[model samples]
Target: MAETSDQDSKTEEPTEKKVRDALEQGNIPVSREAPIFASMAALMVILTFLIGRGVQQITLTLKGLLDDPDGFPLGAPADALNLLTVVGLEALRFLTPLLVIFAVFGLAAQLLQNAPNLVLQRIMPDLSRISPLNGWKRLFGTQGLVEFAKSMFKLASVSAVVAFVLRSSEAKAFEAMYTDPVALPEMILSIAMRIVSAICIATIVLVAIDLAWARFHWRRELRMTKQEIKDEHKQAEGDPLIKARLRSLARDRSRQRMIASAARATLVIANPTHFAIALRYKREENAAPLVVAKGMDVIALKIREVAEQNRIPVIENKALARALYEAVQVDQVIPAEFFRPVAEIIYFLQSKQAPRPEKVQ
Candidate 1:
């Protein structure tokens, strides 16, 4: 049972590595609609301002037309042509800013969400857009359902507001029309205000619904099962066997390097039979001691070979070597606890001209 568990852990090691790689690369796909909703809310506020500005301009234009129809002459051929041109230009001017503002806001929303670039793939010969089946499906889909609901809600809300406004202002509205011609602007504004308010309220309700739907779908799409995540990692990386082979190759190379490094060490500490660690220290001018070489079994054997070839002294301190190997890594300072013992060993080795007998500490 223990052997089987060990084998299972070994098998999973490569898969774990692959999963970590995938996470670092940001290959994960996530929905962008939450940001879209937040941006739309901002857009709605901007639209309200734009609408008010447009209404003001339209009101002024209408007043000018009413006060002097001949001066702005809609009936004359040249005057009509000029008026049409002006109106067209004004419409463009109004729409351009709104379009630009909406586009910029939409882009910012997408950017915030880290949305991938969209690539258009023409699927099914482009007939799907016009197909009755597709149309029906869309009509029955969440978007279509929302649109239907919005239309009904707007109708109900507007009808209610209009009824209330008309009932409350019936007498005053009539009296203003009769008493003051200049008060036409004020009356027009009051009616416009009621209509705008109803529409704004209806829009707010629709936006809220849209936001809720977006959030629901975003969560649904982004939810990943553990198995699905595992599969995705596999797909993004490679099969487990290939990953395992790569890791095996890496560990072999690391073992080789460790053996070569340990060969250069002046002393090797061994755990008698199970573990071995080699350590080399250099005391250069104005520099602290630096470990030049260090390594376990096959690596320890290779270090021993290199030390024999170079005729470098090799001392075997079973306890100290095992402790150093377990507690300190290569290229790191020996722990404070082991420093004194290591220093004593180094001093003894330096003082001895011959290979010292195994010292039992």
Candidate 2:
């Protein structure tokens, strides 16, 4: 009941990252019936194609030994060993193709459903797997009951299919008792082929249904609660407080750099306490005045202090400082609209540097 309540609370679909992590951990949606179908398919193939020739070869080898046992010195233990080796080799040769077919079919079945992923976690030892409580839960839980129902359905369906196949061949089977031993092999193979073919057909339908259900059930199980989704979001995007702190640190570093660069400016435009824009101008270095640093409040005071220490001129201009601070970026040439006012300031500074032509002598 508690588990069902927990499952019901997962209203949100699993995120891609959650699904990816599950895949990496080897938690994949695999229908158990798919591999059973593959085995049935392999068996059908063996019955249809390989079994006839394989059985023929083995029978011929066995017949050679059995038909003339008197010809061989069976009294000698070495002779018996030689005969055993031949029989074993022939048996192995016959079984090899069957084994290969089963292996290839099984691997293909798994590969078709999920791409191969190597997950060591799956192979790692875990106490939970052996815990009696967990085992009991697995055997009696809702999912366990569903699994039980599926197993029972498969067993009944396959049994019915096998019974029907056997019934259809009942006449042939009864005649096998009276039939010649030589013809018995072909008759038996034919009946076995029909049974396996019917089983394969039956399992193909089950495989389709089970494959879809397995994936759907897997996704349903992975669904996230609202709080889990929010927690995952926070983890991915980062904590709000930490992000704000980072932004604050970035602004502080920027202010420090701005104050440091202000020492290179030729003149500092100030609105007393609120705004300061430091301009660097050189006829040979730039086409127009460059605002190398600008700041407000505490940073504005820092820029002014740096300007004072560097002996750079601090010109008070309430309107121009406010306008330039709004319009200009640090390290960029001031725009055209403010050219006249700023140019007049440059002119005044140049006038101060103009050689007093001469005290009129």
Candidate 3:
């Protein structure tokens, strides 16, 4: 009941990370019947392309041996060993090609269905593998039932195909009784081929269905709940609260830098309490007055304090202060629109500081 509820809750499609992890952990689905079909194909190849030549070669060798068994003096155990060795060599020569074909077919089937990789998780020791309760649960589980059903289906299909093929070839089988002994194997091979071909066709259909179901089942198993998706996103992107804290720290550092730089101002324009802009003028530095710092409220107060401590002039101009605070940034020159008003301020300050002209008398 708990498992079913958990599965029901996992309604969201699996994320890319989940699918990738499943593959790395060897959780991919594969159809078992694909290998059986491959073996049947290998058998078909052996019957069609290999068996005739191989059998003829073996038969010629064997016939020569049996026809002249006593042609040479063979009264020793060594002679018997030699005869056995010859027979063994002939058997291997005939069987090696068949074995190689079967191996290649089986490996190709697996390779076509799945990419090969080494996954230690599959081979790791686990007590659950040995526990009887767990084993029993597995035996009666949904996957176990599915496997059982597939086996029953394959058995029934093969049995029916074989029975039908044999029934249709019944007359041929009886006729083989009067046929030459040499031709009996050929007749049997023909009937066997029909049976095998029918079985292969049946299994091909089953394999197709199994492959589709396997992929669907695997993807379903990988689904996540809404909460799980959120958790994964948090893990990748970090918590919102923590990120906000980091941004706040960055802003604080920037404000401190701006306040510390206020001591370099030539003059501070202020709105008495809310706005402040620190300007620096030098003919060699820039064409227009540069805004060294600007801020509002508390930061504006701090800039004013720093300017006063450095003995920099602080003039009250509400409109200019507010306009500079809105339009200018630190280390940037004021815009051309404010050149006339600011140039007048600079001329007034210069006239105030000019030395009195000395009298000639």
RMSD of each: 10.7, 4.0, 4.6
User: In angstroms, how far off is 248's CA in candidate 2?
Assistant: 0.9
Alpha-carbon deviation at 329 in model 2, angstroms: 0.8
> Model 3 over residues 1-361: C-alpha lDDT tens digits?
9989999999999999999989999999888889999999999889888998999999999899889978545799998888888889999999999999999999999999999989999999989999999888788998889889999999999999989998999999889888899998788878878888888899999999999988998999999999999999988899889999999999999989988888887778888889989899988888999988889999999998998788777778888888888888789999999999788777766767524211111
Deviation of model 1 at 360, angstroms: 11
The estimated TM-scores of all candidates read 0.48, 0.91, 0.90
Best prediction by lDDT: 2
Global Cα lDDT for candidate 3: 0.88
Compose the digit string of candidate 2's lDDT tens values, residues 40-137: 99999998999999988997888887898876677889989987888889999999999999999999999999999999999999999999999999
Q: Candidate 1 residues 77-186, lDDT tens each?
A: 99889988877887786677777777777766556555454333423347779999999978987657866876676578768877877787788777985786866766
Minimal lDDT window, size 10, model 2: 352-361
By summed lDDT, the worst window of 10 consecutive residues in model 3 runs over: 352-361
Clashing pairs in 2: none
Ranking by TM-score: 2, 3, 1
1 or 2: which has the higher TM-score?
Answer: 2
